[model samples]
Target: MPMSALRFAAVAALLGVALAPAAAQAHRSWLAPSATVLSGAQPWVTVDGAVSNTLFYADHVPMRLDGVKAVGPDGAPVAIQNGATGKYRSTFDVQLASPGTYKIANVSEGAMASYKQGGETKRWRGAVGQLATALPKDATDVQVTYSSRRVETFVTAGAPNTTALKPEGKGLELEPITHPNDLVASEKARFRLLTDGKPAAGVEVEIVLGGVRYREKGPELKVTTGADGVFEVSWPEAGLWWLEATVQGADASGARKSSGYVATLEVLPD
Candidate 1:
């Protein structure tokens, strides 16, 4: 009885150990990049990483954008906004007011099924913790992160296009400039432009003196940009000349007139 009883107890214990229920674990995973930086007149941030889940069960996940912050040499939080995407991917952009330091955090609730390095599904994850680092500053060194991920990883490692908001808040105080708004006898008025205490050279200069008699000579003359982008022309007679100068391009609106600044010049009647 003693030997049989002992063997039976040993066998019973072994079966119980094998039959016990296994615990269930849930893993929340998103994505992350090694480094991110904020630079440029506007400001930008990026996250580089891969998802723990291989299946990408939730094609769509919500991400929290941070780092829209800064501190004076004293310390203060700069206000910023997390832009919206019209597609399924999650990304964020903010227009920095000035410049400083900042950070960004990303989180996901539901994760995709986990896959083995052999390209097989051995486990599944329900939750995962994913975060990205960012440094936003003005005139600062930018950090870039490079990643090597398996094609099967369910994540948007691909970067989306980024753009800056048109400069606001008294953008670039560019005072309207002017060329020599004057003219003498019918010879191009050797004129240079003026702006912000600098020569407005290399910009088109227009000379309009309507008081000239229209014989065989033209009353109005116009010149385009030359050296320094400024050109010159002559006038038939010098009097009160109506002059208009403009430099077309991206600096000022593509399609804008005068930029709301004009000048007047008097020509000696020759």
Candidate 2:
């Protein structure tokens, strides 16, 4: 393709990423631990990761496990060994030698796109695999927006601790209020969504449990965050849960951008 056409195509992709409706977007990728709480003498925990529309089901494309990291119960790095990427999902194991909360996190490299307008080009960056809508035809090149994303989940060894569940203040983060590792189907799980280290108000949150077939009556449950940046959800059934939030912003240039945040919770049977 010609240089101009190639540039246009790139810009179009960026716009799509910025404006795509929530319902049509791809599933937010996340990592779900096999067990959130380990008791007795177990020193190993496994995590499964995927980019599926549903929760925990590797029905969609597999997520890459290259940059996966695990922090042990003592606030130190845990060994993540034997990572395997399959056609539908990726799996890895963590060696938990102590008794505390473990944190597994992945921050993807930037995914970016740009377009030329009025003889100038603008660029955008978002969570990998985020899609944007087409740029408006009448809009000119006058702004730029950039975004970054990350995913996190926690596991408890021996006893539960909230230390590992604290927000890292990344692009978009969720601070567990109900202890992500201790969720129960009979109770509600509470979380606070934060953006740039401050309470994020009026952001939409979507929680998905297992695949569509696994849901009791629906696919995704949606809720909007209040002024406190907190939201809660009750699992209809015991299973893995995927929570996602997106925030959009624009640089001084007026270029619109967005970032995606994903977290997982393991809900046990009541």
Candidate 3:
């Protein structure tokens, strides 16, 4: 059954799972030695191993495997999709564009829960994989990381080039938004803040718009970020104010940097 998004504590309690309060304080995970690598070049891969049991009732969390440019042999992150009854698989047919050492890794973190009894949540950190070896061997199958644990990667040395056009989707594009001007409370003015080219939420924005050389009562308002990364401030009266947003990331250490864009707007009688 599809799960409804629930609060952290509520989800954990009902799901009979644990939640990592912060990225630093991560939960231990179970990893499986089983994995695959596509030989060649291009994008990077994320290292994954453990059988992460996240979400409401599902035994393992559905994860999309990404690649990293690890130095070792010729390999690229394989394109992946859901296969047969909850199992995810990667398809690599490009045929080792280049033969050299390739690195593999996983860089993702997610959590989900069930909708039964309100909601149950399970939290886990994905297993960190440490696989390294050379590619394009003479044998039909070869092991890269562990000789005792031979993994088979389909790469035929000196194999004939068979190029085929495959349909692929490009990754998403991201941009950053910038603005000028802040709002000062005494002066009446409207204001908004943006981050990463999108509306940022859970941010403490400062308004310092109007008001000039003359001194005025200075008061900073603490505002939480909305999903759209936007908030409206109605001017109590006409004045100037400045605008700025506090930088806060996933961890406490990530909170010190500030990258807020400021725009000035006027609020008049409705």
Which number leads on TM-score?
2
TM-score of each: 0.26, 0.78, 0.25
TM match of model 3 to true structure: 0.25
Better of 2 and 3 by lDDT: 2
What is the alpha-carbon lDDT of model 3 when measured against the actual structure?
0.29
Q: Write the per-residue lDDT of candidate 2 for residues 1-270, one digit (tens) a residue.
A: 113546644644333344653335665577878877888776788888887665567788777776688877556677788999989999998877778888898865444545566676655444444524444354454244455557788888888876666666766788778877788887987888888778889998888776456436455789998899998787888877777777877756564656667777778899
Which of candidates 1 and 2 is the stronger one according to TM-score?
2
| Model 1 clash number | 25
Best first by TM-score, ranked: 2, 1, 3
> Candidate 3, 212: how far from true, in Å?
5.5
Once model 1 is optimally superposed onto the true structure by TM-score, how far is the C-alpha of residue 254 displaced, in angstroms?
Answer: 11
Superior by lDDT: candidate 1 or candidate 2: 2
Off by over 4 Å in 2: 1-16, 21-23, 26-28, 109-143, 211-219, 251-255
Q: lDDT score, residue 67, model 1?
A: 18
Order of candidate numbers by lDDT, starting with the best: 2, 1, 3
- Show model 3 residue runs off by greater than 4 Å: 1-192, 218-220, 250-258, 264-270
Per-residue alpha-carbon lDDT of model 3 for 1-270, expressed as tens digits?
233344544544322233321111222121121212333344232222322332111244433334311222323353332222234322222223354322222223223322222233322211213111111122222211100000111122222221211101111111112111122334433223344334555655554333333455444454555676555564555432333333433324221121212222222233
For candidate 3, the 10 contiguous residues with the lowest summed lDDT are 143-152
In angstroms, the error of model 2 at 57 is 2.4
